[model samples]
Target: MAGSRFVGHIKMWFFFVPLLSVALMPAAPDPSLFDIPDAEAASVASSLGEVRTADAIDTTNRTFKHYFVATGLVQASMASSGETQIEDGGVANFASRWVHNFWRLVYRMVYRITVMKYWLLGMLVFGIAMFTDGTVRRKVRAAAAGYVSPLSFHLAGHGILLVFGVTFTVLIAPLPLIAPYWLAIAACLGALLWKAASTYQ
Candidate 1:
């Protein structure tokens, strides 16, 4: 009874969402809603605390870098040992270069991670859903198998992407929301919820 009731609610959504979208067809949101200029990428970064960085250092000075200094110390040790043999010097030089490159790579990776920390965090949420008991994965995969024909499959695939892309862009980015956008989002949500409910049956 509860599953049927849930499905009934989903069906109701299918009706109401389209009705609401049609009602909104004549006009987009008022300018007061879309006029916020600070809703750009900078604001997103600021909200994630990425834009508020530590004081800038003298990046031009390569020798001042920890990686470079570490390699320099290795080279100095080689020279101080009076090891003039070509083979031994070559090994030391190779080790120094390897250490230098490794640390430099680590530093760059860390810097980029800090810049995109919020993006990574958001993706991890999706990752958790994807890797969990496989309910979401199984439902989507079963739905995928139902799209047999090339035209139907590809069209549905692209339509799903377009709906999600448009919804996300309008919601997260500073963009004008349109009626068709809401219709698309609602239709997708209704269909997915209906499919999920049918699984319980």
Candidate 2:
């Protein structure tokens, strides 16, 4: 009986020792498993940087557009204001006064011409002979025996006046007066040309 009990105890020790050792041992890792890939991490970082760069570029463009729009609005407002001021004060008063004086002069000249037609005509002829291109007048006079043709005199005076007036007013006159003044000069030119043509021969 004693030998059988000792044998049973030894068998129990053998089984329990092996089970305990197995429970305490550390587990071995799988060879197929690995840490995070370096290529994948670099790609993710580069993608985040690209997003930031795109956002910065978009912000810069938006800022420039806003600045340009504001500047345009300011310039437009200033132009409108200047236009209104000119219409209300400077150009309006000057144009009104000029038109009034011009018409008054025209009326006076018309009355004088109607009252003293023959005398004024004689004086105009004398004046042209005295003041015009002396060479042309002398040639015409010598050729026609003291008869002065009015064509050269009128053409020179009217042509010079027309060119000077058009050039001066177009280049130097204000915007408001340019159209009316240019039209007046053109009409004078037309009348002068008509007179020159009639007396050409």
Candidate 3:
């Protein structure tokens, strides 16, 4: 009877051992590409002014790390598959067999002549708007000594550029060429503006 009791206890221990081991195991560390240094974090906060508070700075830093890890995985996978090639300073590869070097050359030439110019202009406008908004928000927050929602700043900056972008497309480009994409961009801009305005108020 003692031997049998001992055997039963052994069986119970054997069954519970894995559970205890699993419970005791350390959790896996987060796969972050890099930590945001204090100086860099402070710089970002300073640049964004009052639009991004300390909490927002931390959130942005974390988000950036997550984005880096996710994009790094995707880039690695693409490289492994030969779908993308890492050249001198940039990525190069065709997504489909139909997209060859000749087509890419022609596309690039056209882009440089047309799309690239407008895109650069749009970017410049957006950057200026962002700087202005950040400056304004920072001044307001400093004066009030209260947190200001970043949403409005982002919306105002993005919305103005998006409006210009859509207008440029409609006025300069063919409707058939821009129709499919214009609505999506317009909707996104509108939604962002609405959310930002609502949040700010």
Candidate 4:
């Protein structure tokens, strides 16, 4: 009876040992080669355009010209706005002092509430806009090679600012009690410009 019991115990151990070993073994990782999609690879290659065996210098000249023209337009617009404030006198000094002090107070209050919180918020908003505009430009460029320009992004940003500025100005201008609200449109435009310049960079 003892020998029969020992043999049964040995048989059970042998059966479970194989099962435990199998369970303990780690699974083989899937191969990475299968991860690449054919369509994605084709899309990437298409975006780069064809590389020429020759210098291909003249081929890209048009792109350079377009970039220069777009940049020049932005520069001209900024210059025309007198944003540099070349002529500064009593009125300009007074306005500058008040605006500067007001913004400083606003910044201090915002910072006290949360360190660099508004800066981060502005950055996040700008990033989203940049991404959206870039995607649009990419699609436009894909459809027509010369359609993409830096001005397109600038115009899009300005258009967004203009819409909000006009809306606020119109809404408040109608209220006789708040005549000063009309002036807020200019303030909003200035704030938008400052935000656009700083945030985009």
Clashing pairs in 3: none
Residue 142 of model 2, lDDT score: 67
Please report, as a residue range, the 10-residue window in candidate 1 with the lowest summed lDDT: 54-63
Model 2, runs deviating above 4 Å: 1-148, 151-165
Candidate RMSDs in order: 20.2, 51.4, 23.5, 34.7
- Model 2 lDDT at residue 105: 30
Q: After superposition, how far is residue 106 of candidate 3 from its true place, in Å?
A: 6.5
Model 3 poorest 10 in a row by lDDT: 25-34
Task: List, residue by residue over 7-67, the lDDT tens digit for candidate 4.
Answer: 4444444444434433332121222222223443343234323452011223333333455
What TM value does model 2 have? 0.22
User: Evaluated with TM-score, which candidate comes out highest?
Assistant: 1
Alpha carbon lDDT of residue 57, candidate 2?
41
User: What C-alpha lDDT do the candidate models reach, one value each?
Assistant: 0.41, 0.40, 0.41, 0.38
Full candidate order by lDDT, most accurate first: 3, 1, 2, 4
- Each candidate's number of clashing pairs is 0, 0, 0, 0
